[model samples]
Each structure stands twice: as C-alpha cells, then as structure tokens.
Target: MKGAMKALRLHKTTQKIVDGLKLETVPIPEIGPRDVLIDIKATGLCGSDIHFIDGSSILPKFPTILGHETAGIICEVGSEVKDYKVGDRVCANFATPCGKCYQCLTGRPSICPNRSMIGVTDDGAYAEYVKTASSALIRLPDNIPFDQGAAATDAVATPFHMISKRSGMKPGDTVAVFGLGGLGIHAVEIARMYGAGMIIGVDVDDYICERAKKLFGADEVINSRKIDAVAEIKRITGDGVDISLEVVGVPESQLQAVNCLRPGGRALMGGLGAAPVAMPNTGIFVRREWEVLGCYAFENLEIEKVLKLASAGRLDLSKTVTSHIKLEDISVGLQDLHQKKGYPIRIVAVQD
Candidate 1:
C-alpha cells in the first residue's frame, strides 16, 4: 500500500478524454485518522466523467483522479477506524456529508453544502487505491459482484432516489421514463418494482428503445426522434402518465416529460445539463397543477437500499454491465461511451 500506483489523472480540462487524462504512476494515497485505503476492484464510468473531460464540469484543482462509482476491498485502515478492518468488501458513497450541517439536521444530507465529493472535489478511484472517510463506506454483500457493487453507487442509486423519494410514485401509477441510458433503464426497472401499472421508455435511439422493452422492465418503448413521443404516450395511455421522469438533460426531453403528464401529475428531473430550459406557459402550468421537482444524488441510506434489493434478487442487474475493460483501456471505453457506441448501458473498469 505504500508503493507507486497506476492512475488516470486529469491535469486540465480538454474536449477529448484521451487528451485530458493521462495514466501515470503516482504514489498511493495516505489515510488520515478517520480514513481508510481501499484497493479498488471495480469502477464504473459515468457521464459526469465526460463532463469533466469536456470542461462542462470544472475541477477545483489540477491532476486528480476521475472515477466516482467504485467498489473495493479495504487494504488499510486508520488508527481511529475501528468498525472496519482489512479485507472488508465495501463500496463508498461519493458525497461525504457533514453530520452537523442544516441539510443533515433536517434529514436531507445528500445536498449538504459542506459535503465533499470523492471524484469531483477530491482524488477518486480511477486507480488501484483510493482514500476515503470511513463514514462513506457501505458494506457490499457477498452475493453482489464487484462490478454491480460499483454501479450500485451511482447508476442504480440515483434513479432509485428520484423515484422512491421525490417522484411520490405510488403503486399502480403509470410512469414514463425519458432517456434510456444507464440511469433511465434502471428507472424503468425500479418503476416496475414499485408496482407501476405501465412503464414507457423514451429515447432517441432505436437500439436502446428496443433493449428497454426486451431486456429491461419497460412495457413500451418510444423512439422520440422518429415520431412525437408525447402524442404516442398520450395514445398509449388515455389520459397521460401519472408520473414522468426526465433522465435526459436536453430541453426538448424536459418539455416532453412535463407535457406527457396528466393533470396533478408529478415530473421528476434527474438529468444534469448546462443549457437553460424554458418552463411551460404559465396558464397551462397553472391549470394542470403539475409539480416539477429537482432530484440530485442519492442519500447514503438509499445506496444501502439498492444493495439490499440487488442482494434479494429482486433487482436483476445481470445485463446492466455492457462491457468490462482494463484500467489502461479506460480512455477507449470513455470514447465509446461518449459516442454512444453499441449503446452501452454501463462500461466498467476491472482490476485483476
């Protein structure tokens, strides 16, 4: 744990992943009193990593590692870390919330202003070893593999939070998920798990739409590019869906998600986009009495719930991972993800 480790470091923001990230031999991270060192076993690539490379998201410092969805084994523990010992299988929540903040006191710690994110604000797990506070660790069940454990940190937990907590999804409610990417596909499955009467998956690509219906739990799929998705959804459901989730950050999809809802319906916004989105007309919005809610990352307890679902065999993630690549091939994987190659749901980096 003391020697040099190979890591993908970002020294500056660039338009391309290859140009921004360099695989270098750097010293392993040192642990503090409340910290522990994890030997990273698997890490999942996310769209936020692309945002970092394209300069859409800026890092506070230069030369930091870039992966946040991670799972690993405890290699070393600090002197003050008594609950966890070496060789414990665990996955970490990227956001470390300060327990005393106003957000934490009110039971909403995911948005803690003083929270520190693992990949965005600090060095993360795109390497062999990562240092994290013990408080951020979640126990990974033995039944779950490292790859799925890594994905559970973000890809699964994010949508689960939006649906279970923010969307106010009741059993038998009709649901529509816009954008069948990693998070969107899981949204379909989670909606079904929550006893949704009908689940529709919307996307611009035909391949993902097909996969959403065939493999995932989507009852119907719509190619938004070919036809009017809102009209088709209205046709499928006589009145419109009771709940709609906009997982695509584009303005068009956001508008469609809102318009596809029934009166007094809820629209949960889970996607992250930089462009400004125009709200619907005031008269229509007021008449419909629609509720629009913004959902951020998951709470720490939500990650545990996702893991429990995965462990119980209720949530099938066997087909979630599209491909597995070595740590050195992460740049190629990122490029394929950015290009939508093979319509990958999730690309993971695995260490031998």
Candidate 2:
C-alpha cells in the first residue's frame, strides 16, 4: 500500500496495433492539498483510450495514464479536503472545469476549454492509486457495485446528458442509436428509460445487435454491415426516426445519423473520430430544419443522478458489462476491443 503499484501505460503513441501500452511498476501518486488518493477498485476500458494509444489526438498529451471511467475507495484525503474521508467509495467527474471559464459561467462546464480531464491531461485511475481534485469526487451509494459506479462516469452519465439535455428525447419518440459500443448501448437503455416508443440499435456485429435487443431493451436491431442503416431505419419508422444518436463519429456514420432523422428531427453526435465530415447541402438543412448537436463528456450533476438511479435499481446496467479482468490482462482486453474478437459492451479492469 505504500510503494509502487502496477499500471498499464502508453509510453508513447504508436500506429502499431497494441504496441503502445506496457505494464509498468510506477509509484503510487501522492495527493496534494485539494486532492484525494483513491485505491481504484474498477476501471472500464473506453474507445477513446484506444484512440490515445493509437496516436490519435483524442488526448492533449502522451506518456500519461489513460482511463476515465473509474470507481474506488478513498484511501487518503488531502489537508484541504473535509467532506470525504478514508474508506469512502466514490466515482468522480472525469474533468475539473475551471469555474471562471466562459462555458462554466454559462452553465456548460462540460465544454469548458480550460478543463483538465483525467487520463487525458492528468494521471488517471488505471493505476492502483489516483490523485484527483476533491471537488470532482462523488460518493457511490451502498447498493451500486464499484464497476457500475465506474460506469456512471461515462457510460451512463454521458448518454443521460445526451438524451436529457442535447437530443430532447420525449416519451414516445422513435430513436435510432448507431454503434452498440459502451456508449451506444447506454443510449439504448437511456432511450428506454425516457419511454421511447421504438428504440433501434445499429451495429455491424450480429452478436452485438442481438445483445442490444435481448439485454439492453432495444426494440429493434439493425446490422449496418448487412443492410443500409439509413434505409432500414427509414423503412422501420416511416418518415425517419424522431431522433438519431451517432455514437461512432466517423464521417459516414455521422451522415447516416443525419440521414435517418425525420424532417424536423435532431441528431445528437457523441463520437470523436478525427476525419472531417461532409455535410449535405445547406439548402437541405435549411429546408428540413434538422438540428445537429455535439455532446462532450458529462456534468457532475448528471453523474450523481445516474449513480442515484443505479443505486435505487431504477436503471439496471449490470448486463452491459461483458468481462471483468485484472490489471495485468489489459493488453488482451485492449486486443479484444480493437479486433472485435467479441461483442463486448464494456471490459472492466479490476484491481488485483
């Protein structure tokens, strides 16, 4: 508990597949006055971490610890911290927004340009211990498991923000969610939670599509590789869907998401692909009155709400997790995610 801890780290960004990360013994970070030291219990793998490892610009810098979805028990608190104490189970907001920023002042702290995100701009929870600002931590309720608590940071909180704040999903709206990854799977659950009349989940893998329908409350499942997603969606819901969420941020997926929307529908984009998107003619957008919105991370309030919901059994996301691994098997987990070896919604790395 006092010395070095095992961690998976990206020494540098690389194009070579799975070569960017290495298991290293690093010192447990020391907490500052406004920070707390967390003995991480669980951390979920994210697609963005793959981008960071593969030399993508998803992260601001390299040679840093890379995990955002995390939950743990507090082992130590800084001198300035008082509301929390040792042995407290908690998950935290991934970034600490500068309260003085214009976006923060405007009540959009998730988009604050000056925010410092865990695993992107600072050392993250992939290691045995992580030091984070006290203000970012949220206590996990007694009933929620640590992995589920970890998932609240991104998997649940993100889609909650998108559906509740960005997409304007209503009680009976039809929704098409493209990409059944961690984020997209949650999109389905959240859509159902909001009383979606028809929830369609789109993914290339047939297994994922099946899981989305059987486990995640998706009313319909579309295999993008087998059929034209946009056409199928239009056929399923006459005049297109009421809302479309593009969880995969590639140009093609973005276009498909836009194309699958009704004339006056909204498209909420959450993916972070690097390629530039080609939009339809300006006149088409003008004529249709379709709205396109971009969603970033999540708000602390939303994360707290999701945690509370999960704790109360109102939101059941335990089925979304596919595998639980140890810190040493990170490469295998990353490989499974990268190669599409299995239709894994989430692969969590638990502390050894």
Candidate 3:
C-alpha cells in the first residue's frame, strides 16, 4: 500500500469491461512525444466508468485501465513538450483528442471525431503514474485540494461545460436539474454560479433533496417519487425552467426532463444510464418545440473556468466528497458504486 502502487483495470473484448483489477509491478509511465508523465496524486470514480464496467460504453480497443478524472504532479516530460516542466501540479482535459479532426478544428473538441477517453480506449489513472498530452494538461493552483483536482474534470469542469458553454445560460435563468448525486450537485452549483435565479434540484431520495438545498445551494428541492416534478418545477419557476438537465439516466427521470422544460426551452441530458434514450413524439415537437441534447465530457474552456472557480472559491461543493479509499479497497468501493449504495460526494482512489 506504500510504493509503486496497484490499479483497477478492465480488458474485455468490448468496452463493457468489468473491473478485472489486479496487482502488478509496473514501472512508471514514460512520456511519449508531446506527452508528460505525471505522478498521480488523486483520481475520481466516474459514472462513465460504470457504463464501461457493464460492457455498455463506447470504447476503442479493450484491455484498458479505469479511472479517468485525474490530478497529479508532473514528473517527466517528453523532449517536445512545452509550457510545462517537472514539479508542476496538473489536471487533464481531453483524455485523448485527435487534433486534426474536423470537430477539433471547429473548437468543439469534446465532439472530436477521433477522440478517446482515458479508462476507455487507453490506460488511465488508478495507477501510480499516468501519461497525458502536454496540451491536455492544465496547471492546477496550490489552493485546490488534491482530491478536488482529481475530480476537477468531472465534478467541476464537465458541469461548467454544460452551463457556461453548452447551455447558453444568461443571468437570472431558471434551471432544474434531475438527480442530486455528484454530477447533479455540480450542475446545481454551476447553475448558481451562472446567476440562475432559481435552481431546482430533483431526486427520488429525500436525503438527496435535503442535501441539495442545504449544501448545493438549490433554491428548491423536489422528491420526484412523491410529487409531480414537472408541475412542482413549473410552480417554483413560474414558467418552467429555462434549462432542464437530467444528470441521472433513469427512464423516469428522462421522461420528467422533457416535461420539466418550458415551451421553447432546452433539456440537457448529462447522465449515463446504459440504455437507449426515448422521448415523446408529438408531445415534444408539436406541443412545445423544445430542444433536447446530450453532453459527454468537456472542453478546455470549461476546464479553465472551473479551475478559476475552484481557485477563487466561488462554488459551494463541500457536500460532494463523503468518502475516500486507498487502492486496496477499490474493489469494495466499486461494489458500493455499482449499487449506488451510500453515494459519496467524491469517491477518490488514492495512493496510501
């Protein structure tokens, strides 16, 4: 539990790779051209890892390492790497982006035609070391905790992408978010930071509902199982939310997301449910003409914005981290995660 370290890995034919975690004596990663080798300080467990574990995620080749949200210290850099050096604290954005792709050229690298995420197509964190493109690594401030930096990509960056870049949110917009888990909490905080007038947080669990208002700054919290989320949201916002986000992938939540939107509003789906998305036919297009979309991962601008928020201390993300475990307990942690049992604000796999 001390030195070189262990990791949780998956190597199935398809990406629906389960956790085939094992202990091995591996050397520190070597930097490739345009790469930097990092001594991983912290890494966050993500919902996408859940999809991949069940063999339901999009992946390139198999035999990949898990744990994507990474924060670490630069240990080595390739000869060609620039703007960074050894001893820098860093976090990564594009796990792997094909810079020549059309999507990359358009400054929408999140949708890059040939991008591959860590722990999906390639080896990721959950190890003592990780290597990333120098361009993908952003220097982290000393004020950000190692665990928060590890989660910067998921808890901070991705939601910033949805609110600041993708949502086109202006000041005083009303936003409703479905799910009070990690990403849902992030959505709530990010919406508040964007000057949203009212933030409606939703979940089936009453604990989450209570937690939303107390910790995440949600102006209103709803337990969808007992109350009609759509009607309640409309009642609170008085016009339905300008933007409604589904951070939980349950079929019921998805259905409620469509109804939660005001006419001509937008519905953004950021959760991963491992099932096909189904929406009403005439009810959506004919009645409201609402816009429905999905966002995966994030881009550089959002990453920078989130880092600034963390550095300046503008966001209330205190309730998000409820647990931590060393590499030895990763299997137990993964099991708890699979069941959604005792949802943690941030579950970090770290070196002991």
Q: Which one wins on TM-score? A: 1
Q: TM-score, each model?
A: 0.98, 0.96, 0.92
Q: Which consecutive 10 residues in model 3 have the weakest lDDT in total?
A: 11-20
The sequence of per-residue lDDT tens digits that candidate 2 reaches over residues 38-105 is 98999988878888888666666656888888999999998999899999999989899999989999
Residue 207 in model 3: shift from native, Å? 0.4
Q: Which stretches of candidate 1 lie over 4 Å from their true place?
A: none
Winner on TM-score (2 vs 3): 2
Better of 1 and 2 by TM-score: 1
Backbone clash tally (model 2): 0
The lDDT values for all models are 0.92, 0.86, 0.77
RMSD in order of candidates: 0.9, 1.4, 2.8
How well is each residue in 171-279 modelled by candidate 3, as lDDT tens digits?
9888899988878888988888789988989998898789889877899999988999989998887768889888878878887888888898888888788677757
Model 1 over residues 260-286: C-alpha lDDT tens digits?
A: 999999999998888776479989999
